[model samples]
Target: MKNRTILLTGGGTAGHVSLNQALIPELKNLGFNVEYIGSKDGIESGLIPDSFPDVPYHAIASGKLRRYFSVKNFTDPVRVGAGLVQALNVIRKTKPVAIFSKGGFVSVPVAMAGKLMSVPVIIHESDVTPGLANKIAMPFANHIFTVFKETLKHVPKEKSTCTGSVIRSELMDGSAAKGKEICNFNNDLPVLMVMGGSQGSAVINEAIRSNLTALLKQYNVIHLCGKGNADSSLMDLANYKQFEYVTHELPHLLHMTDFVVSRAGSNSIFEFLALKKPMLLIPLSKLKSRGDQILNARLFQQQGFAHVVEEEELTPERFLAEMQKLQMDEDLLVDAMTNAESPKTAYEMAKLVAAHTKN
Candidate 1:
């Protein structure tokens, strides 16, 4: 009999872990044993365990893969090698029929180990362009899944499929009333949610904080300021709430939000689109990323789903102007989103992954 086991790996950021989190329960409901392998220090390490206490988590050594010269570059390869060894051992012990990876530096060694052990490796790339980790892991994968059709051009097309975005089911069931209650706000003003991805963005934080007084004049603000970034001075302020991070509360928060200002990670942008929330997207600068968010943001803008403000141009004036524009274009953006292709449900995506397992 085929081993009814599946191993999931990914995590440097919440983006890498979010899809896996969405998949775990579905995979388990499909009667497959789901386990996770991720970096010992990645957000996944805590997220997976906290979210699903039953699933076994295997932490492995991982090092960031960087293009720029770093003193750690020479040493990181050593950690990668160690991660490969640890992953191989985990695979041997668990004997998973398949390994599913969401693209992150922590996943590279897991994919390599899966290939070396003759297990089928599947990768999911959420960006319009493949990330460096996915690029490195592609050749080792039996098949690749992409959130955007545009990504097919960057990866080997023969083994790749555009599965589109997979949204978490619970996100759809959020209570807007509960969301407002969570923030202790009322319907007196429109709600604006500002997020800077899972880790938070200093630039975005500063922009929002500096303009908080002006923003609170017109809209109640929910700011996910990232871990360690929240200002104590702002804690007592009415019409504004700040969180370092939130997991279960995210859906409710999003549900109550009238507008969003966020970095253009594919997962987040897609969630906003799915919810028909008008948004102003501030993509990470090329200096900070491989320009994937730039592509993600531009595509959303082209489709009239969001307003794009490149990080380099995100001055206070520009930020406020874009917010006004987003407000003015809300109906058009919502209409565009309503007509856009629907995202695959977690159950559907789970079945797709399960189909590729070894029998």
Candidate 2:
């Protein structure tokens, strides 16, 4: 069977790549060949090639247009302008049937190139709040998919579809039983999963530390500590599992977890929902993160999948108190998560893009 070529572009973080990753398998199942286009700096560089060796990888150079100022921002436009030209050359060479973008600064060039080349350019917005890049690209896109209904306000309604988030489907119905055994966890006890996105969350780690002794008495903790936090032994308890990184065991980790504590990155949010686990989201507000995490958590809070604890309010006491509330209300939490849209996300997104692209 001949495969239709799809040129997928997106990534500055795992949020973008995770969505891209989900679609690759789905698109391929439909007898389509997928190629990736992203920048050198993002996690996509390492993840894309490793995850899908069958796919061709293309790289573009770009400097982020941060919401805040730096010397880099001043020079980014020229670099990105060059990227647009280079990406145009790639689109001309590959002649892909369609382009799917998970918008970030890096996606700008290729999305623009697709527009110039008269290719169908589809974008998927992963957050409740659209980022600066996606907001700009909306007008030019043939179709745009957003995870949040709120994003429609920022993006042109004509170009956008609220499809929820695209996540790996098997996660929706998978059992955490296997993970419980692999992690050497006890099923009788509740397991709390703490992760700070793909890179790890230091604030979450510190908060856990301050409250660890208290938390351990009630919950078995599984912490993905990025690559640099103290080892699992730091817990000084027998019930905790800690890892600097656990790419292979991520699903299992989520499966075995009774609940989650994570940053507001969209990938983590959807994954937790896919697992139907309750979560406490602590958004990054200290830097130029632009409160994407905050917005993500706020939406889920409105839906009852999570509770938002701002960094300022995220002390050991508050963290523990929040967990206690969730523990007390576990059944309601489960009901809320089970009712949330998920598992069919990639299929929903793929169907939308396919129909639009065909038109």
Candidate 3:
């Protein structure tokens, strides 16, 4: 009997899982059984199960692949070895024809296991530069897909394709009316959606909170403040809604937003572009990241799709000023977005991946 199962792996942050989330239904429609391998306690553990209750979720041990010196660096290799064995077991039983990895620390072991098992592995890179995990996993992959054309310079060009971004279809189905209702906002005010990534940013949170009173004078605010970061004191503030994290309701909130203030994660910035939302992007500094977000933000700025505010320069005053500037440049930004390349639909992306599956 031919194997029709497709295994998906990636998770540490929400970005790693979101593309898989978008592709799951499309893969199912194409008659492939989909399953996920992720870290036991990573964000994907909750996201995959909550979003697709029936799909099997396999938990495996994973260690963070950090650049900085850490004591765990010595212990993590053992965990990676264990994860590889666990992944091999899952691949043996499931007999997936192919494994698609979205490139996080958890994905490295899975990719290695897939190579060892002779299952074709496909890896996707969402940034201009390949992340460390993806860099390590690239050799194990049969093919690679990149969201940015510039990424080809960093990966093996012969096996890579720049497929652009793949956006979740549900995002386009949101209603502005539902969005307003979700926020319990009534008065006429431009909406500003603030996202600080899945785990939240203390710098962003502090800047927003300090300037909330001034910001309320101009616009309604919807803050996705990350888990356990919500302030109890601000709970009663009118025209300001704060959520620790939002899943299904995100599209609706985004639909109602007139402007966005967010980190420069490629998946997120591209979604904002697709939605024609003018944005002020505060990318993670080079000290905190490999500078991929900085590159992503710069490209968007060059294209006139967004405005950039470096984290080092961010203050309550600067944040508000940038918000005002984003509003002023809204028309130009929307115009630029209108001319930007459309994202590949999940169905199209699914077909592409399906084409690569072993017959």
Candidate 4:
């Protein structure tokens, strides 16, 4: 039997790589050879090879896809063009049955190469609106899976499916006791996990710290403080713990987390929803992003899965108020989350790739 091969592409932010991560083992379980095509130094470079040592990995020239003017813009396209040539060669060599993209700048060139090479391409969009990279790659996608039903309208209707989010099976395996053990928290207090994506958020770190004493009184705080963001002075706080990030232990952390405070990245929030953890989402300000996080936060709030606070509205007082609100409505949020559908989109996607492989 011929090896069924699928090439995965996504990077930049941890959000971009998350769906691809969810799909990796699922594809492997279906007997397809899993490999990744990513930028040489993006987050994918660290995550893919390290997390899935068995998966063959390739690095290619990659350029950032920017929406605004910058001096790097001119040079980046040259890199992007080079990436296309490199990607075309890689796809030709691998002869993958299908290409799956989770939408990042690195993916744009690869998707274009897949189109030129006649390999079927599948792209998953985690936002209500497509990012700059996916918009460019839309013409190449054989199918576009979306996390939100609302997002379908933004893409070619004939090619789009609302598959919800791709959540890894391991994300749901968290045990509260194991989580408590890992974080060294007392069971006497509820655990509150704060995540600000992979690199952490300076704004969130400040807000939490300014209110740390007040917050620690009510809950045991576990802060994923981003790289270089942890404060040594606060290390001695009895009810608080801080780490740069958690990976293998994330499931356990999630299992132990009774409530959450986080930025409203779609991938992260959806995972939190799957765990039925009530959340207070502080979306990245429009000044910081294209306001995707803001939209994501609002939608989750509307669905009763979380409470939303805009960055402009973020303050210690308001943060605590929202936390109080989240605590008061915990049962309702859990009920909403319980009834919510997890499309298990990665499996649906794996089936799609399998069908393409068979054909």
Candidate 5:
């Protein structure tokens, strides 16, 4: 186990990249050389190398698995297959001890290639419901790790471990508190952190756009306005901090904020729990992206971790009302954060996979 090489592949969005990022430094800390493989068009291209400047960076043409008709859908698999071949070559050259996957089409190839090369393969499902990529990679993977207890049904009992979803160590490892001066607000006012999960939900932005003034009256907001959505003309905001990408300050903002209005991406949901911040979670609808978010949000709501709402059900009025309700039920917030899963069990998955490689 001394200085073994490990290759990790996942990302088109930050949800996947963040999980990949969470595990890298820790793996390096354990004395493994780490390489990241991601889509050239995805968040990984920027986030991965930046976070681990010294680590090797590789890009593949990968994409989302769309539910409905799109011109781009047909060509995605072909591009992904090419990336898979490329990933296989990288693995052959590195001879990694394990391939860690976090559910991206980019990862599908990496996981498969690892299995084919007789290297260990471990896949971590960040959602309560597994993604299509995970579904495809499950059979080849030697072990599975997940954030939720429910994901076990989708994975073999022998191979699956509930380690929670691994958030970046910089994030959930009791390091969430930080410089209050950067936020520029008193400890009295509530801070609402709004996240759209890597792409910045247009619908969430619309809701906030319609009520920025109302939001400012009660709370200070730090909004992660995905790549192109930070339109200042939408509504003049006071006490609002906007970022196209805030790769570094996620945990600090989570700690500083009293509440959140967020998309219920599995990774995001787990972070809210880790921080014990009450959330008004809006799951993208059933018709959206294989309904993974909808499935994930329902599971979290069932566990009483967050109050779930659909984007269609969210309005400025609804958000304000939910805020009032959450403000009243302050006790529930603390109770919900005592969740069963954790994000640090990636080490457990690694050990299991490494064992399989021996066999």
Candidate 6:
């Protein structure tokens, strides 16, 4: 395996990139060389370089796979064609044993190139249903890994496996004491973590702000408000803290969290579930998204891991009510999470990739 170089590609959002981040350490431990392909300006280019400094990073042209009509739609196909050529050139040079993609638009070209170059390509889909990018890349993919068992029916059964979400080991290393120290939160009050993906959600932030007085009565809040979403005026409030985002401190933050209020992004929800945190989920409405998050939230609710309130209905009053219900059932959520059957999926997925590399 030390002689094998595995090419990895995914980007656009933290969800797409973080799964690859979770797998990198395991891949390195398995003694494979890692090389990442991402867009020149996607979130991956910024995150992967810093997270995997030892791994070689390659940038390629990428286009967004928009579901709506827009002027950019006219030119994005041209960019996609160019990206395919760029990926082909890189694949020819790297000649990787296999390519594993987390399925962003950036991955589609690389997956096609891998197919043309006679290299096996594996893709991981993190949602309950495949995203548009994964749908495009599936034909080129030799195997597809899914985070949810329900996602299997949506893809070609022969190529799909419900491997579950890859929960990063780093997340479990967070210290409650260290988290308290970092956030200036006291152990007397329960800590609530509010996260809205990497970009942060305006609705979530605004609801938290509008309800801070009431929320602070029972819980201290550690808000990861995304880049530029922090309110300077709220800095002086006790039992409340906000950050644009956390890099190294997220594990600690998770450790301190007794309950979570979050968007229903599959990656974020699964990480919360892995930690046994009771969650109140506000999924992105169909108006704003492809409705995957809505499905994610509902399934988590059905599985007894979370409670869901759609974005259209997510006022501070409703959020607070749901939080109270979640708090009352905290023990139940923990019990369900404890008995949940996703042990070592990340390791197994890594091993599967390694096996394919040999073929």
- lDDT over C-alpha atoms for residue 221 of model 1: 98
Which stretch of 10 consecutive residues in model 1 shows the poorest summed lDDT? 1-10
How high a TM-score does candidate 5 get? 0.90
Q: Which stretches of candidate 5 lie over 4 Å from their true place?
A: 1-3, 71-74, 172-179, 233-238, 339-359
TM-score per prediction, in order, is 0.98, 0.92, 0.99, 0.97, 0.90, 0.97
Q: For model 2, how does the per-residue alpha-carbon lDDT over 133-218 read when each residue is reduced to its tens digit?
A: 88777766898887787888887787778887667775655557777776676547788888876777778889987887888888
User: In model 5, what are the clashing residue pairs, if there are any?
Assistant: 164-342, 165-343, 166-343
Q: For model 1, what is the C-alpha lDDT against the true structure?
A: 0.93
- Please give the ranking of all candidate structures by lDDT, highest first, separated by commas: 3, 1, 6, 4, 2, 5
* Candidate 6 lDDT over residue span 131-235, tens digit each: 999999999999888888899889999978877777878888889889989988655989999998899999999889999999999999999899999999999
Candidate 3 TM-score over all chains jointly: 0.99
Report the error of model 2 at residue 96, Å. 0.8
Compared with the true structure, what per-residue lDDT tens digits does model 3 show for residues 1-359? 22499999999999999999999999999999999999999999999999999999999999899999999999999999999999999999999999999989999999999999999999999999999999999999999999999899999998999999999999999889999989999899999899999999998999999999999999999999999999999999889999999988999999999999999999999899989999999999998999999999999999999999999999998988888888888899999999999999999999989888888
Better of 4 and 6 by lDDT: 6
lDDT of 5 at 228: 84
lDDT of 2 at 202: 76
Which residue pairs does candidate 1 place in steric collision?
A: none
Question: Looking at model 4, which ten-residue stretch has the lowest summed lDDT?
Answer: 350-359
| Per-model lDDT | 0.93, 0.80, 0.94, 0.87, 0.76, 0.89
Cand. 2 Cα-lDDT: 0.80
Q: lDDT tens digits, residues 134-245, model 1?
A: 9999999999999998988999989999999999999999999999889999658999999998889999998898888789998999999999998999899889899999
What order do you get sorting by TM-score, best first? 3, 1, 6, 4, 2, 5
Clashes (candidate 5): 3
